[model samples]
Target: MAAELSILVVAGGRGSRAGQGLPKQYRKLAGKSVLARTLEAMHAAAPAARLTVVIHPDDQALYAETVSELAASARAALSAPALGGALRQESVRNGLEAIGREGEPEIVLVHDAARPFADPGLVARAIEAARAHGAAVPGAPLNDTVKEVDANGFVVATPDRARLRAVQTPQAFRFSLILAAHRAAAAGGREYTDDAMIAEAAGCAVHVFDGDPQNFKLTTPQDFARAMEQLKAPSLADLPDVRMGQGYDVHAFAAGDKVWLGGVAIPHSHALAGHSDADVLMHAVTDAVLGAIAEGDIGAHFPPSDPQWKGAASEIFLVHACRLVRERGGMIAHIDATVVCEAPKIGPHREAIRASLARIMGIDVGRVAIKATTTEKLGFTGRGEGIAALAIATVRLPEG
Candidate 1:
């Protein structure tokens, strides 16, 4: 369906509480500005909707820097930053007026850009509700104890929490109703906390739908720190070190098989069968190399169907991975591999395997360490049903 809605993102607040010199919306979160993530959420919610960001005049440089760092697809969707007014309401009115000059939308969504974790589903539901019922906003039912207090620290009475709801945006409304409401509020000097409150005071019924708790606004320095922590933890789990990558592979042993454990062909009574030679060590190492560059898994790059790879020696695959890392401006730091099996005492051949892999990868033997272990007659590998190999590769990229 053709979306006839424009998103007016109110991001111009000075954010005095955050105290980072930059507005809270422009603060870094997960290596990118919070506004960028908010914009991403808005676009994901409504891909076709026109997005207008209201930014403080002083924040133009900060906004530009943040948008420039975003992916091409995200940057392309952004319109130039429009200067906001003295208040958030005025800022939103400025954004609405600009969108009005472009083309009057069927509906408009006014949102706070500090809430980066807004759910796309909730936004969609809010828009649909507004389109059908005239105006709508997402809200979570208040579940905390409510107390009413007077000035001078006097407790009056406890209100019912069940009767209250904590509101969030994108607060949706018909274009005509919201524009007129904002104009009236602006003319009457009525500055409300949220757009829905303004609409409610203007005799407009604002429907409320359930919203997510994760959509809480990032308002404090601590909140920014938490977001940064979340981003780094996931990336760290995926990468142990700049000079190390780890991998593991396993295959079952069947009758009439030529065992290819590593890149080296080991003459055996049976052979491992799979999409490829099923060289556990090579597959594990290939994955480690790819992981270092954040490139993806081996299966994503090389599928089993390619005619050139049928029953191909796994060494060729390992060489290709090494070349890929080098091409991407990275060097192998070190790699440690281990083989597991009940039979085939590989302790004597560890040095040979290490030297062979080091030669193939064009690295020193010391940088490549290989070891073997037995499963102690426990499971599949322990029962001599198959062999498994684990590899860890350390790679380094030049620091910019």
Candidate 2:
């Protein structure tokens, strides 16, 4: 049954009401385009269903770019986009016809590209309702009182809000039933707002199932802002995998007047000796971050054997480590580092070192903690012969 299911996403509107430029479906919400998020949600709900998008003729380039943003699995679920018509109803008809040519599906679902938050439960309910009644739509009960007004702006009637529902998609249907209804509507020169209405006009019984309130459509700039905030809000139900890693490093004093510590150059009696700028703090932090992701140490990535990194800045290593975390869909939550040294008084430059580390890691200064400690003449660091630093990193990754 899953293999026989198909979905059509309608995205042909100019979206002038949302803004002056760029269709709302193509606009970005968070870091992803609205249409990409919608497609990903639908794919997650019905992995076996064949997905298709209906788009305007002028939006070919934009459509391509949006599809490129999707994951490989989501992209694999999609068929070629069907060219849309002047009206939304006409566009849906074109999409249905295109799906028919590819091979008619037993069931079909029509959804709006601006609605990106549909969950798996809603889709299961939609499929079950369609199978039972032949046509179905998801609708949420209205919360506000509804009124019917006359042309003169006088209240004509106060309808019972108890029976009213605000409808949402994907509206599910048995394939042959809705195709005939749409064909009949087009032939009779009658246009309906949604497929359920057209099915009703064609004498078919349409069922209404419960809908999710978060499945609201994106229609205005305010709606976009709200969606961004909603995505940013952390939920316990989808908590990330938190991890911590520790790193330690030591560098001996060499024959230079300046030393690099946490990407900051400070005047000192001797420089730290290493392949790189030998910023002990930065190297320890970089190793800690890499360890948090289980991606080996800094030497494994940038080996001392490689002469290309002979005089490289330690910031390069830290930046590369952070980039790797982001590439894996993870984030560095916090970093705490303690420098072990008896010289170059770390107290006077603590804030500067913290600020420098934050800028290099692309995180806030508050997330980076810098502290200084001494072994009280009990270790080599107390003898002022070398500088040692230890770091602990916390990271969060998407739960597998």
Q: Each prediction's Cα lDDT score?
A: 0.76, 0.88
What is the Å distance of residue 193 in model 2 from its true position?
A: 0.6
Q: What does candidate 2's lDDT look like per residue over 1-400, in tens digits? A: 2349999999999888787779999998888999999999888667779999999999999999999999898899999999999999999999999899888898999999999987655776677678878999999999899989999999999999988889999999999999999999999999799999999999999999878777889998888888987687443234479888889999999999988898778899899999988999999999999999999999998899987567776776786788677656677889999999998888888898998788667578999999998999877998889999999999888888
lDDT of 2 at 247: 90
Identify the leading candidate in terms of TM-score. Answer: 2
Expressed as tens digits, the lDDT of each residue in 93-199 for candidate 1 is 88888878777889998889888876555676677678776888888988789788999778899888887888888889998888888899988987898888778
* Candidate 2 lowest-lDDT run of ten: 230-239
In order of listing, the candidates' clash counts read: 7, 0
Each candidate's TM vs. the true structure?
0.57, 0.60
Cα TM-score of candidate 1: 0.57
lDDT of 1: 0.76
